[model samples]
Target chain A: MKRELTCIGCPMGCRLTAEFNGTEVTEVTGNGCAVGARYAREELTNPKRMVTALVRVVGMERPLSVKTEAPIEKRLVFDCLAALGAVAVAPPVRIGDVILENVLGTGVNVVATEDIGG
Target chain B: MNMKTKRVDLLIIGGGPAGLAAACAAREAGVTNLLILEREDALGGILRQCIHNGFGLHTFQEELTGPEYAARYIARVQELGIPYECGAMVISLSPERRAVYVSRTEGIVAVEAGAVILAMGCRERPRGALGTPGWRCAGIFTAGTAQKLVNLEGRMPGKRVVILGSGDIGLIMARRMTFSGAKVLACVEIMPYSSGLKRNIVQCLDDYGIPLLFNHTVVDIHGRERLTGVTIAEVDGKKRPIPGTEQEIACDTLLLSVGLIPENELSAMAGVALSPATGGPVVDETLATNVPGIFSCGNVLHVHDLVDFVSAEAARAGEMAARFLSGEKTAGERIPLIAGNGVSALVPEVLSKRPEADVTFMFRPRAVYRNARIAVFRGGKQLAVKRARILAPGEMAEITVKQDAFCESEGELTVSVEEVGA
Candidate 1:
C-alpha cells in the first residue's frame, strides 16, 4: 500500500509518498530532507501531534496558553483539551510550569506556553 | 483644551512584535526616552490570541508558540525598562514626528518625538470589503476573531464550520475547530493556489483530512440570523463565479480568511508617502519612508509571511531610527527600484548607490513559476540574477544583493522573473 504525506517538521511542507509493506515503510520519496522520511514512517505507524490550548487563570481577565511538552497520540487531542478544560491555575505562572502532569495518561505533560502574573 | 506635549527621543506605535523589537533595538542603540503605545489592554498584540506553535524558528532557533515567542521580547522590553502604555490609541501623527494619542488613564496625550516607528500592524479584510452578498448573519466570523474567541475567551463559535478562504488563519482554525470537535466542511479558495504557507496547508488542513477546494468561492451566504449554510461555486479565470455551478453546504459557521490589509490610517495621517503596490509607506534601503526622521516596518510597512522576519526587519528599523536621531546624514543619491514584468510589490522602493550594508530585497512574484530565475537589471545591463526551484505569489521571494551590485547600477534596478537559463 502507498500513502501520501506532508512533512510537518518545518515550513517546507515537502510532499512525500510512502510505500508500506506489512506495517513497515519500505520507501519514502519526494522529501526535501531526512525529517520527511522519519515523519512518513511515524505517520504511517503511530502518528502524534502537539496540542496547544488556553486554561483559565484564577480571577484574571485573560487566560493562560499551554501546550503539550511533547507530541501525543493524534487521537488524544480532543481528550487532552477536555482534560485541560477542567483545570484552572493560580498565576504568577511561569513558562514550562506543568499545568496537567501526564495529560490523559499519555505521559505528555501540558505546560504553560507563556508567563502569566509574575 | 490645553494639554502638555511630552517630548521623547523616540515614540513607537503598537506594542506588537514590531514595536517591542524596535524598542529593544533602539534602547540597545543608546536611544533613551522612548515610549511604546499599544491599543490593546495587554501588550504582545495579536499574538495574545494566537496560541499555536511554529513561531520563532528563525529568531530563536526553536519552534515556539505565539505567546511564548512574545514573552521573550516582552521580557527584554521589561528588563530594558522601556516605558509602554497598553490601551493607548494613537489618534494622529505628523510628518514632523508629532503624535497625539488617547487612553483612559491619560486622555488626549500629545508627544513630540525626534523619530517615530510606524509598526501599527494590519487588520483582516472583512466580508463587507469582499462585497459578498449575505444577510449580516450571526455565525460568520473572520478567522482571527474566531481564534480569539476560542483561544482567549474559551468559547466555541460553532460545531459545523465552512471556511471561505485558505489563508493560514483559516487553515489553522479548520484544525482548531476540529480539535474542539467541529466538523470543517471545506476550505474554499478563490485563487487557484493558497496564499498561506505550504506547512499550514499540510499540517492544519491535510493532517485532519479536511478538503481544500481551489478556484472556488462562496457565491451566496444563507440563514436569516445565524448562518446555516453558504453557497459555494467554482470561479472562472476572471475569478467570477461560473453560473449554474453553485453548491450549498450546511454549516453553522462561515469563517472568512480572505485577506489582510496593512493598517495605515496613522501613516496616512502622518503625511507619509505610501506605495500603491505594497499598501505601505514607500521606504528606502534603511526602511526610512519618504518623510524624514520616520521609518516603517513589519506588517504595517508590508504584510510579512513570518513573524521572525518581522522581528528582524523591526530591529533594522529601530537601528535606523536610532541613527536618524543622531542627526547624521549621508551624502548619496537615492536611486529608485522598479518592479518589472513579473514582479508585484517591491519593498525599499529606493536604495543608495553604495549602501552601508548588503540589502536583502523582498518582493512577490505575480504568478506561479517553476524552474525560473529572477534577474535584477539596469537598462539592458543585468546586475544580478538568482535561480529558484519554485516561486509563487503566496510565498514572497527574496534576494540579498551586495553593495557592489548597487554600485554597478547607476540609475534604476528593475527586478523581474525570467527563464532559468536566461
Candidate 2:
C-alpha cells in the first residue's frame, strides 16, 4: 500500500509519501530536508498532533479557548473533541489552567488557551 | 590571514518586521551601533506578496495591506537612520551569536555582535507535502509565490484555477485571481472548518462567489507540461478521501495555501534548540535563546497567523536583544516551557531561571469554543487565569507570565484552558 501524509511534527508541514508493504514502510519521498522523511515514517505508522480549541467560560461574551493538556494520539483528536463538549469552565480564569480534569480516558486534560477577565 | 572582523553592539538578521523592530528597539535601548541584514533586495519578508488589506488591526489600529503595513515599519527604520544591508544572504550563524554573510559586492564578511536576533520568517507548504497525484507542472505554485509573481512581477498565472487549503493566503488569492481576470473554480479544505479567519471566508470567497468545499481534498492532479485539471474527494471522519467520490475539476492551475513553516535553517545550524510544537527556537521573556547572547522573534520563531502580531512580538524580542547587549540582562538560570490543554504551541520556548521580567507566550486553540477559561499553573498550583471569547483554529492567543510568578517557582510552568459556560 502507498500512502501520503503531511508531517505534523513541525510546521515545515513536509508533504511526504510513503510506500508501505502491509504495515512496514518501504520508501519515503518528496521532502525538502531529512527530518521530513523521519516524520513521514513515524507519523505514517503512529500519527499524533497537539489538539487545541475552546470550552465554555463563565461570564463572558464568547467561549474560553482550550486545547489538550498534552499531545494525545493522533487518532484520538475527534474523540477528544467529543469529550471536550461535555466539559465546562468558570470565569475569573487564568492562563494555563486546565478545564477538563481527564479527557476521554486519554489521561490528557483539556486546558484554556486564553485568559478571561473577572 | 588577518581577518579584521567588525564587532558591533547589535546584529539583526532577515530585515523583516522583527529585524526592523529589533533594530529600532536596540537603538532605543541605547545600542547605537547596530546593523540589519536582509537576504532579499527588499526589506519586507512575506509582506511583499500580500497586496490585499486587513493587516494592522491590532498593532496599528487600522486595516492596511501587506505592503502598506510594511511601509510603516520601513519608514520608521529609515527615519531612525538604522544601517542595514540589502541583498546580503547569511551563509551561516555561529552558536556564539556571530552572523556570517555574503553579497555580490562584498565577497564575505563576519559581524561579531554583543547580541544577535534571528528573524528569517517562514515558507509555504508545497504540493509535494500534500501527496496529490499529479504531474509536476509549471502552473502549480504556492499562493504567496504566485501573489509575488502577479502583484510584484507584473505577470498572470492562468485563466482558471483550483485552490487547495482554506488558509488566509489561499482565500486572499481567490479574490485576487478574480480581480486579475481569472475564474477560481473552488477552494477545497481537508478540515471541516477553514484555517483562515471568519472575515476572509466572507470577503474573499463568499463575496466573490467562489465555492468553498469543506471536508474535501485534492486527491489527484492531471497535467503534462502545465496544470489542466484536478481530482477532488470528500473526506470522512478520519479525513481520508472517500473512494468513488472523486470529482474532476477542469482548470489550468492549482494554488496551494496549505500552511507556513518557520525558516530555521540558520537557527538549526547555530545549534539553537527548537520546540517540536512550534518548529522554532525556544527563548525566554527577553526573547534570548538558550545560547545567552542569541535571540529570535517574528515568523522565524513560529508561523504567526497575523503580521500585526508578528511586529509586536518582534518588537519585544528587539527590546530584549538590546538589553542583552547593553549588559542589562545576565544569564541566571532557565526553566522549561510547558503547554497545557487546548494549546498547540508556545513561544520563548524556554523559561529563564532567575527571570527578572515577564514573558509572553503564544499558542493556538483546538477548535471553536463558546466560553472558555485560560489558566496558568506552576508546581500543580494555579498562577493566573483569563476568560476568552469565541476562539478558533484560525486565530492565535497570547498569554503573559508575570515576573512575580517566576520569582519563586522552580518547576515546569504550564498554560491550559477549560470551558466554563455553554
Model 1, global lDDT: 0.88
Residue by residue across B119-143, what tens digits does model 1's lDDT show?
A: 9999999988988887998999999
Pairs of residues at least 3 apart in sequence or in different chains that clash in candidate 1? none
Instruction: Give residue B64's lDDT in candidate 1 (0 to 100).
Output: 90
In terms of lDDT, the best-performing candidate is 1
User: Candidate 1, B224: how far from true, in Å?
Assistant: 1.8
Residue-wise lDDT of candidate 2 within B203-303, one digit each (tens)? 57865679999999999888899888999999999999999899999999899999988899999888898888888888776777877788888888888
Q: Report the C-alpha lDDT of model 1 over A19-81, residue by residue, as the tens digit.
A: 988589999999987999998899888878889987888987667889998999988887888
Model 1 residue runs over 4 Å out of place are A7-15, A30-38, A58-62, B330-332
Give the 10-residue window scoring lowest on summed lDDT in candidate 1 chain B.
Answer: B403-412
lDDT of 2 at A30: 74
